[model samples]
Target chain A: MPLPIEIVLFIFLLTTAVVIARLEDLFAAAMLTGIFSLLSAGLFTIMDAVDVAFTEAAVGAGVATVFILCTLSLTAKREYQQPTRILPFIVVGITGAALIYGTLDMPAYGDPDAVPHGHLSAKFIEIEEKAFLSQDKHAAEPAQHGSGEKAVGLPNIVTSILASYRGYDTFGETAVIFTATIGVMLLLRTRRREKKVSPPNRDQMETTS
Target chain B: MQWLGLWHYWAVIILMMIGLYIVIARDNLVKKVMGLSIFQVSVIMFYVSTGKVEGGTAPIIPEGGHDLVYSNPLPHVLMLTAIVVGISTTALALALIVRIQEAYGTVEDDELNAIDGAAL
Candidate 1:
């Protein structure tokens, strides 16, 4: 039997990751990293996380690649040679070992009895289903649950949870984006200042000459 | 059978280790950012893997359907927050890299440290 598409894509993801790690040229690494992100997005889609995949494709493969390309243009493409790698290697090795050991107690993949499935998410699903069922019986009238707006009529439960059930968290995430946008604006603000100051200095030099 | 079930996690661990090694072993600032992105991505993978169901479909409810086995949506929602955070961090890191290059004329950690050491 042939390898599953997921396994094949996973192989590609791992290969790109390794290649990105080994490449010395920052520009090439950036491109490979974009490919890695796309592959991971594919993996997310395969795992039934369509929203996550969309965000990954946009943010990871698109915005991140553009940001890195801009940074690459600003900095040298080549990396400087390092003197020693022993310590960093040992540190990474130990960390990886610890993490692998920690995974020993984790629940197996796709197990219905997994702890995450038993949480409040299950309750959310139950509520959503009940709302759907009630909607069928009350087709002639408006949903009485409008008092609480509990019937998140969206077909995508992920969207409903993200936008309604966990609206505060989404608000915080938006605030985080706003903060980062401000940080970037502040960091790169000098260019505009320089642009404004340059013409006057050049004009003064020309007059003096 | 247990080992087969755990391969997904082990692969993620390997990817995470590679990212860690890049962050630790590389001197280039931009490369470190890339490694950080990879590390975050592996974390997303870990979370998404946990959300997978054996026979699950996407979470979108079809018309008048209630028996569909949808994969866990909570992790997907949480990973959306994480994905946004990752992008923000990457953007900020890149901005910082640009500023560092402007200041030191080099993005290499050792060179920046050496210059700072000389100044001190």
Candidate 2:
């Protein structure tokens, strides 16, 4: 068989990750990270996920890298060495092993015979025609049993899931962002106050000396 | 290799793991962010690869061919929104990093931690 597309994409992704991991210089690593993101976006496009690829190219490869670079400019580039801690590694290994074992009990990817197909998905597919008709008729009925096909019309399930089905969660997430912004503003404001207050204390110390 | 058919997926997974490792293991803040970007890209690759059908054509509707086998367009649509979200996240993250630098004086986690400890 020809080289599978997944394998090729995998190799590319793995190489990018390894390159980023192995690099010692912080700036070079950040640039490589951006390259990795771009490559991943290409991989996404090939996989037929153009929208995600676009996002990855623009955000992962573009904005995130720029942010990292800006932060690097204000910091030392050298890595600090520390003694290795083994306890966390052991816990991680055990957790990972358990997760892998759990996955073995799950359905294989793209398996048409999987239980998911025979479950609610089958009902959804079978009722899809009726759902469309009901939507056309604009009949008043319980929203829960309806096709949930509104997600398709929205052109984005993730957004629909966030903004509609889980609107409350999205609202909470927005609140969290707002809260964090407020916290930052407060902390920064206090820092300015401290700077102003410190001058008087320094002057007093100098007079006593 | 008995599992050659799934090698591509495995490779993507490995790449993701490597990226994650770098993010976790590196001490340099920039390197950590770079690793995070790599990890995120790996996820994007995984999502995109799932849309591929063995012999399907582009998802675009054909003008004349009645028997055209178009790939599923759902994944592509989802990816577009994902891209937008990713961009938004990246912009926000960069802004945070800029603020962090201004406040902390140094971006190195260890140094920042020491400064914080002294302040406390």
> Which pairs of residues collide in model 2?
A6-B8, A7-B8, A10-B12, A51-B79, A51-B80, A52-B79, A52-B80, A55-B83
lDDT value for candidate 1? 0.86
TM-score of 1: 0.92
Lowest summed lDDT across 10 adjacent residues in model 1 chain B is found at B1-10
TM-score of chain B as predicted in candidate 2: 0.87
Summarize candidate 1's per-residue lDDT along B1-120 as a digit string, tens digits.
575677778788888888988888888999999999999999999999898877888778777886878888999999999999999989998999999999899999989999999999
Report the C-alpha lDDT of model 2 over A7-79, residue by residue, as the tens digit.
5755666676666666667778778777777777776666545556666787777767776776676665655
Worst 10 residues of 2 chain A by lDDT: A151-160
The DockQ of each candidate is: 0.76, 0.27
The top-ranked prediction according to DockQ is 1
lDDT (0 to 1) per candidate: 0.86, 0.56
Candidate 1 residue A67 Cα shift, in angstroms, is 0.8
